[model samples]
Target: MEEKIHITDFLVIKNAELEIKQINVLIGPQANGKSVIAKLLYFFQGISTEFLKGIRSQLSKRELDKAIIDKFESYFPKYAWDGTGFSIVYTINDIQIEIHGQAKNKTKTKLSLKYSEELKKLYTAKKRIFLEKINDNQLEEEPLRGRGASEASIYRQHILVPLRTSKYSDFFSDPIFIPASRSFFANLQKNIFTFLSSNVDIDPFLTDFGSFYERAKALFKEDIFIRNSNDKQLIKNLYKAAEKVINGEYEYKDKQDWIISTKGKRTNLANASSGQQESLPMLIVLCVLPILKNPNLPKAQALTFIEEPEAHLFPSAQSLIVSIITELSSTFDLKFFITSHSPYILSALNNCILGSEVLGKNEKSTERFQQINNGSGAPLDFEKVSAYTIMDGKTINIIDSEYKMIGAEMLDEVSDHFQDVMNNLLNME
Candidate 1:
């Protein structure tokens, strides 16, 4: 979309539009539609990829238009698509993506995936499809027409992680998400242990991330057995990422029904401290991303969506998670969408942008700056990051990485007063 989303008559999105970014951080009070927006992006990205699965070997203007419209039915009728007073648009390449729906009697859903320059909708119809090539650019496009034919083929090779620990655990097989209630993952250790040590074909999304988590755990389980010379490098890389984040390597002890080894001590994943239970799997996943060079899956890219990775972590540890992701993203190809309420992470992200603005400069290399950025070895480029706040109906970018500054847009509204009160109490003058 235009890096901004506008909503009215929609849930909590009364009249707001947000700018989207590579490192999209959504922060706002509870029930303010932060998660809704994040999940929408996840869905849109999934459908877009699904819709683009078979490329038109022939990229003629008309050919491209026809091919895109043909898949329209694949994305319509989203589980939560029934609504009105809503409009979302984003332009990527030559295509403009738009979704419109309203709440009224027999509300209609209209989605526009229009080619801006051609002035032609993919499908045109009186009420159901957009099929005509129009001459005017000023005509506001309507949303999704009736529905395209449902094609099973359109849903293949798609990965969309929802914001639930168990629901999206399967995605963790590829290190995609780290949920807020990370500690809750322990309850699944028993099930996961069974899935790994047995020959069961279970649905991961059935109960949340199980498919992926079990499979990922199976890798660690296999690594212990397969220590083959061919795979040692990849194995080392995986654990190295783990060690970097946890300050200790990770190993699973088959004895006592799936225990994790950290710092030479063995403990059941369930028995690990709240911090360990919450942070361990997430840390391992972080470790898994950069080091996971040659995965068995055919997927070329990974999009990770973590909900409150700061859970149960100390301020320093939180920054470490941010830093490791930052370092790997600097080198490897990884996309992350995180939802958080932690200022530590917000400020750390701001510093990432700051470091980027003055990389290699004497000031940035100073010990103080380096310490502030201890989480990452590489300077973070804010241009690659987009921070937003949902306190308002719109998602607004707060960190102007280009200026090396953090805006008040995302700070706690009471933070200003808090600062003033603290300053007066301390008598800093």
Candidate 2:
């Protein structure tokens, strides 16, 4: 089963085709459609959730179609719809879905959808059984508005359980988008859910991110009381790696997030540094991944979209953050899709790829790789890594096929340009 996407005439993106991979990185300047592409991927990958929503609500074919369209429009607001027209084609495991958007009138826009027969057949069969169960009063008619455990459990039992045994199970994982404005939610952690519920003007992506952020934090509210020592040690190692990135140990107290420094001073998020505020939410997720993967807790596989993970950090810290990601990815069933403006993060990822290449050639270099950066290094599968840079309504692959890593020249171009400016100024005398 192959996974790929084609997007054309969408926002700043004129045309782009990307092969989805385990480690996908999109690097570009601001407003060059990096986030736009990320959101589109999120929306399409999340079609499984929409399908479940359709069955749970007993939506008709037309109603389901409208629901999906509404979701797409919500992600791309009316202001973003100013584009003349757009089309997106997403294929995974041979199930293809196409969406075309056009301006129907000045006041309205219509999104036309075409789904593969496999998807339609699966949805129809599931919906039929769901309707039969409802008619027989064999399943609870749980309200989905709460989005609480009961609703999740009901859906999992009715839909996910069956899908898990089928060939389409790979499509069931949820796509979680962690937006660049994650710090805003981190600062409002105490009241984010209430604020989001009361306010409708906030971006839908932020709302979803806030929810996941909250869950990640809650994972650390209590102690990790696992019986497995290896699992426990892995969590400790991950948290230690994360601490180097944020420059402090994270603590949750009195229903708030706090950071304890090396000197034992405690600073709550409100009084903490901007770096902490910006990095805390992402760091918390890094800390919680292993905990969620524990056999005791309910485990879930997810396609995680991380936007500007290097936001408000030094270059060394940025490298450490990438290390944390690689370590977790190596250990867990998570795939990371990263969007970054920082070449430091990309360079750090390249280091991981290079380490993998070295190890691939000579297994004896394993010890040498571990010696780099105090054992923070983790080897990546270069085959599963893909990098692209977006500009001028297009994306260019930056991954070097021969080297099996992002090319050094691509990472150095921006730095080299600024250095040339410095050199000219120095010679002005």
Candidate 3:
């Protein structure tokens, strides 16, 4: 199903599209609301009316009112409302899921979900169960609706499961609103798992080299004994992959432990490098493995958001990362939304365009390139790529060096103005 999510007034984003497979790279100076856009798209589900209702019930009347007012002032600077309320609307596969509310009082919010055929089925089944439980109690209406609300009375159990399942996990797992203090530790644990278990083949080496018995004989200097065990061979292969970027080879002694060989001696990963250097293995593992393991996930009709992927890597690595992104999009059914401040990453995308042109010289490939070069022919064509620059005001404007704005055809004046600014910046630096 094609999925499109539109968020309004939840944060810095006034309105924006969150869709999959197409890479939307947001670039601008600091405080231009780039991170705000990421937060809205990634946490759309968590900001729903149901979740907000629960939050309001936990806060004091004044605190709840204050929170609502603050979110409005921050998200919509030009507009102000005396009312305390927020809403999120999500459209997926022709179904509209809307959750909206306004503060009914300081301690309570009037919240409701706009039901669809899909949600209605789940809601009906749950409502029936809730009514059966309430009928068994035979309590007074006022007390049932008031402080004695049980779990079954307060929530529709079946409907609640749908809200908490994997389909809605992204809302809570979003890196932006989900507090970095807790997420940092969670992410670290996930990274460690990827580092140890990913992309290592063991069975082939074991069968070809006999097994543990052959290795024990080799230690006694016996002829025809296995030269290397399966564990050692796997470690050697891992080391070779690491050596492609780092200075030395890495060895995995056990499933949980790894050692790096520098010079002629072996050292634990922690002791092999300083604290700063030790962190690279984890970063590299996280950045590269996610794409490798689920290269086809983008094709699954879900949006994927990545923020500042160019952190803590050299220029060459950054270029390679962009190439990986380009290759994955072309080879799989995926859309990518990425944000970056690195000029090198942008230049790498530019090279993808140029490289495609150069490779189209052959008559057989020329027609294909022409189709992609012309936006009307293919949905994934290069023309579909757009770059937006966020201006000093909250407005985002599109700019391309190759095209002149309509009614601005004086090339000489435009060139002079650009050169003057470039000279001034250079002089200041």
Candidate 4:
């Protein structure tokens, strides 16, 4: 069974359904909060207590607590939080979870969780405590300063996993939260491989290649020697799916720095072209490892979120990336959610749909294309892919490639529309 995520009332993804092997592309104008949506989801899994405390400074304790409670209630049956005075209701694998949160005005917020029968009892007790503390007179006591609000506690309890080109250690751990920054790519060349090959007693040069070397050796029927060949075959393959080849080599002497030889043999990752050069390594990290980590993991069940994958590459590279993502989805139990402003990426995705259709034309062709029961199988339809444009005023309108309107706004839209509803509820004495 695939793990599905239904996001409601969080960032720009008001109401979005993300399933495995599915590619969800968020396209539209800039500053439309695509990054915000991505950040929220990345941090949704295991929110840290420290981060939650930081967000508490924005709203009153009563209002923040209610918002947190509502969020938990929506995801019920799958996951739960207890103690902490915050509650979460979401289902994963048929199991129900109820999250609890604890906040004492400006004091530190504590979090706890419950499941099944225990979740209900915990929630009831929390609800009573929360209501009892909602006295209007407490408003003058100066809402929780700093990271001690109920909302902060709730956010800290749910984690967000980010893959960016910047340093965000407060949120991610090594091999878990991958930053898309230049240093991150450089580190992949230096650290990732060595960490994987720690158990093997191979030569130092081979050891420097890390897990990538092992994976390459297993995939291709040949040895990838760093110094002996002097040819660019291995480097060529690395840049095979990429547009421009900046420079990639296994460096010796400097165990810490993995040199990226860009234009004019300048051996610094900082010197490489901005977009594609920066994007290539991130793509390798985001795409390849997830597949290698769990071979049996279903493509239709995994959710991979990428932000601005079209960062640095030519049109061709962008197109290739779209194809790679599509192929990955088709092969593994994976679902891809990416935010892009590049028309080339969108066009490439459209081409995948067309290509699939062409292959589904005949019985033998269809069988080859779908790999299922000849022409009787369903053709590859891109319509199953959903795209949304987040508009101003918190309104998210679903649109097609040509900006054609697709009916059915998500619950996020409803919440945005009823902003006054929340304001009124919070203001009620």
Of 1 and 2, the candidate ahead on TM-score is: 2
lDDT of 2 by residue, 180-282 (tens): 8766865675776787688559788888987887788777634644343356766777778778877788888788888899999898887777777878888
lDDT of 1 by residue, 277-344 (tens): 77776765665454354444323444577777877778877877777667656656466788887777
Instruction: Identify the candidate with maximal lDDT.
Output: 2
lDDT tens readout by residue for model 3, 271-389 = 43342233233333322322233322222223344555555556655554565455435544335556666666566666565555456544335335434432111112355354443
Best by TM-score: 2
Clashing pairs in 3: 21-334, 21-335, 21-336, 22-335, 299-333
Of 2 and 3, the candidate ahead on lDDT is: 2
TM-score of 4: 0.48
Model 1 residue runs over 4 Å out of place are 1-9, 52-83, 104-178, 191-208, 219-248, 255-263, 291-302, 363-372, 407-415, 420-429
The lDDT per prediction is 0.53, 0.78, 0.43, 0.44
Model 2, position 274, has a per-residue lDDT of: 71
TM-score of each: 0.63, 0.89, 0.48, 0.48
lDDT of 4: 0.44
Error of 4 at 89 (Å): 6.0
Q: What would you estimate as the lDDT of candidate 1? A: 0.53
Please, what are the lDDT tens digits per residue for candidate 4 over residues 1-429? 333344444433445444422567676667776655544344343332222332333334444445544443443311322212333344434434444345544344454454455423433444444434443325546656432464334333322222111133212221222223433444454556676677744332123223443343233212333223333342233334432323344222343333344443435443445763466444454334332433222221334666666766677666556655665555443456777776666666665565565765643453364333211112235655766656651434354445222222442454576897888888995
Candidate 3 — worst ten consecutive residues by lDDT sum?
Answer: 174-183
Ranking by lDDT: 2, 1, 4, 3
